[model samples]
Target: MISRPYDEIKLLIENYLKKEFSTKSDLIWSKPPSVELGDISFPLFNIAKELKIKPEELSEKIIAEISFPDIVEKVNLQGGFLNLTFNRSIFVTQVLQTILEQTKYGQNSSLSSERIIVEHTSSNPTGPLHIGNFRGSVLGDVLGRLFSFLGAAVNVRYYVNDLGRQIAPLVIGYFLLKEAKYKIEEKGDLWLGKVYASMYTFLEIQQLKQKLSMLGWKIKDSSVSLYRLDDTDLKTVPEFLNSLPKENEEKDNTHKWFMKLTRIQSSLIERIPEVYEKLNKLTSSKIENLESTTNQYVKNYQEGKDKLIVEKFREVTKIALDGHVETLNLFAIFHDDFDWESDVAWSGEVQTMLAELEDKKYLRHDEKARLLKNDIIAEELGYKTKYSISYEIPDTIIINSEGITLYPCRDIVYHLHKLEKFNASQCYNVIAKMQQLPQLSVRLALYGLNRTDTADRIHHFDYEYVSLIGRKMAGREFDYVTPDELFVLAQEEIKTIIEERNYSEEEQQNIANKIAASSIKYHILKMDPQKSVAFDVKKAVDPNENSGSFLQYSYARALSILSRSSKHDINVQKILESTEKENLIIEKQAEWELVKLMEELPSILIKAAKSLRPDSVANFSYSLASSFHKFYDACPVLKAETPELIKSRVRIVFSISKCLESLFEVMGIEALEKM
Candidate 1:
């Protein structure tokens, strides 16, 4: 009747091995492949080789000599492995009582003394957050929750890039539209997205025309008439060019790719033609050239050469962030702190870093930029071998010849500032895998600066990209669904499923919001972080499928079972403490399987938290739900033959609901009592 049977069993085995071998061994424990084999197992292959004995001989000798405790029902030998089966009646009772007794069953003080910083979803404040950004946000939020649950003080921060290159066009467009008659009807981020796309496409179109002209081509008017300069007469390009395949199919067709830019320009105009036309017309007449103006804006803002422009940049960035916050709120994701890149720049940290690198002789000046001699630094520091990294560490540009500090350089300064400010021991940057080299460069730069301890704690929690199946999304093109739109679609799908349930409109809305958020969160977090996800909305919302909705519904059903049982007959403490072993029956395979899965919640939490993977927890939740469903179908609860058996089953259901509720809390899924 040990409360934590798993820990007790592990300790028992380790002690036996240490005493028997007269030495400590690194023992690894695992579950047997089938329930009939055993509850837990340990392999003896390595230990056998060390002792110069056959693996099977070692396993048999160890099992024969080991003292079997009351909790150990049976011990068996299979090949080089030793497996132990727990007494089912005792196991079920102890697991249930332990869960019911502990308030925070899966939480511990393992990381109580550590402070962690998680910065994610720091999408440029130039537009609405896309689904890809949302994935990072969800991952970061879950990590924060997990760390806090493990007793670490977690700071969930967002790194806002107010002074980025993307912000220049946004600032220009915002200022242009500020005095115009055009109205901003949608959210600020969405409107700003349009502003960015229109300006970017406009600049690209003009730049393309200029390049084409240099290559013996001429374009006239906004309709984009193309004529080759080598031809004797001016002529419109053949219509077949428009029917040509996209860049993916024909990468060599440079001219055709140039023609595709005009179509994007057309799409931009079609969405917001009036404002686009006004900006294009003004820039065309040289009243204000978009490219030159934006470049000047970026240069001035970066150098603090123009106070007015800096203020405007901050103002526009704030507007875009406000819109982002609004959208994130709908998904229950919020950032605890917003660290601005401009603030880091203005604090002179970037310059200080560069000066230090120069002092250390790690800085190199090329014709175009100031480079960090990472190749040289890596060799001197033995960086690649020390870190076990496989990629080539290339020399990185820290500052351009024009004296603008690059992002990776600024990023290093930012990391140092945050760690010092927050007194954090660990930092997890939830960035995409595409930026792997840049992230590694940041780490290598930290090592070059002799911040090895700090660098060791910095983790790039990289995840693969997420795209909706059958749709291609380019954030710069503004041809993608925003998080806000995705939420709307999810809610609509949930609504269509539950509209006929006869609930009040408000309740229906509440249920829809919870289920929809859970669906999206579960769908994203269920997949491994390194695996690319092709999201499907229908699959996400389907209750019959293994989804968040299914987990919630299973929890609700379990709660319903507990509610229907007579209060007198559902007392977990009395059943576990006072009931006879014969009466507390758990003979069915399904019942024992459910107990085994429920007992694993604490280990699962620890594993997921340590690995920085919410997907493991998501998979566990689904399995728990599936196991509960199987048990529900096979085992009788309220109508059992005896009150003691009914009470035992009731405790199992109660414990599962508690386990799931805690999981939902960690995953940030809303736990609805009613499905």
Candidate 2:
């Protein structure tokens, strides 16, 4: 409803300027700083300067030349600015009526026919997701919802990295641990997480031994405790060896190896206690065999030759994905497709892509590996200076020395497949900021293929990391917090707040879960994508703070008001359509302010969608909730002096509730009727 009048005003101003000045200008409108001024303001300084006339005189002439429609009640010129005020009573009534009639009042149809794909949360299937990955999940999920609300044919996808180096170790660890009869009763992903960490520690110890042996140092006691490195005198070995003072060259060599050993030992001591026992159980021969087996597993899986290895990989990957799905369900995140990296390799899509590149003369084979010759393509696309800082552009490697396809190469095939399969014109990869270079390389590869349409439409919705207590979380470290853990913690906190309420046990649990999930989502999404979030669960669930629960509680409060009014047998429809001017009176400043905030919803939605930032909508939700609270405090609904006043206030409350519902829908927030 607001967009209609806003568009009408823009067209009116554009046509008026073309006729008056015999030239055209881009007419941009902004809101007045204060509600008392006007609904929209248009600055006249630019046009005034172009016409070589004083802005004050230009504003006056424009005010006299153009006539506002019935919707625009008054036009005032303040200095060099032209402000237009709407008929508040009529605009509010009409907007409320339209919101009541339309199921989706704030949605627009500008991109109704365009197809888009939003791929996100493509975490490797080696472990459960930490909070860092959850940030991207929330961002992508909200974007999918926002684009769909704006009438785009959006498909959400998750690219599973099932054929990466991480998966190799996961498979090896599962088999090795199963042979040891290690039983895990927890989530499979969590169990795999422990195994993966232990494997890394074991591998590190083996590498350290090889480094020591190269320096002619042998360990006489394999029974020495690997866990007590903190009490071991590793530094003394380097010092004693250095003090021997043999030939300068030999002395330096001994110093180097001992220092390297000390560093490795220090790293080993830093590992969690569980990794120590795993490392102690790994003999040198077993470690060597495990390394060879991991390589064989990857090779056979890639070549599609080993059925047992393939099935083992799939079984473990399915366990990890099951855990992923469970966590995603807690946040209400669903994807239209789950694209496996192995599928790109198995379906011959990757080979087909390589063949096409070779046909286009973009593929080159160096002595060590096959590479995509992007230097010519980069120059052709102006990538060196256009895409990023001039000194940061690097050539992309398509395949390594072992004839294995890299992730970026596989990503290129995956993206092209998505475009061809879905016929989508736009694709957004909601990945972390650390992968900016890889993402850029993929886009360059697309451009190199002369697929400029796909290249130009590829958007990297890059976001920064999410940290807890100034420490970033990594899944492989086994020290990070999981989304499931955070959900449990949030529920415990929310339970304490709602325990005294008269709700049943089941109702209490439901409310706690929704509030907990909402709090987590809001905390992750309330900030700009480019900024890092220091997550604090306590502040996130507080009803007094500008949190998700606060917004939900605000809606619930409005519902409570309306529920009370229903008992009075008030005819809401009759009150909304009342023709009596005095009965429609909104003399309170708070009511007018709330109406103004409600009127900005359509414009806010359009801006948020265009900017690809859900934070804008989140910020708007907070402001709307704040305004509603202010109105509730200042104006009385059921306690009004007259029946008409009560109806008027109720109408405003109902409109606020509707607008909030629309906003929550776009933000992927659950709007609760009771909290």
TM-score of each: 0.91, 0.90
Candidate 2 per-residue lDDT over residues 180-208, each given as its tens digit: 77767888887777767666545544444
Q: Mark the regions of model 1 whose C-alpha exceeds 4 Å error after superposition.
A: 1-3, 23-25, 213-257, 270-287, 541-543, 566-583
Give the candidate number with the greatest lDDT: 1
lDDT string, candidate 1, 1-675, tens digits = 234788777777678778877644577788999977899898877777777888888777767877776778988888888888998887877787778677867777788999999989999887888888788988888888888888999998999888787789778777877866567788899888878887777666556555544544445532422211212211233333334445534324545555566567666667677766776664455434566777889888887768899889988999889998887777787788999888877787787788888899998988769888877777788786787766657888878887777888878888776787679999999999998878877877887888878887889999999888777777666777676776777788778878878888999899988888888788788889899988765576554563888898888889778766655455544554554545246858888899989999988998998887878889999999999999899988877777666877877887888889889888888888786
List residue ranges in candidate 2 displaced over 4 A.
1-3, 179-181, 219-288, 355-366, 381-392, 470-472, 541-546, 573-583
- lDDT, candidate 2, equals 0.77
Q: lDDT per model, in order? A: 0.78, 0.77
TM-score of 2: 0.90
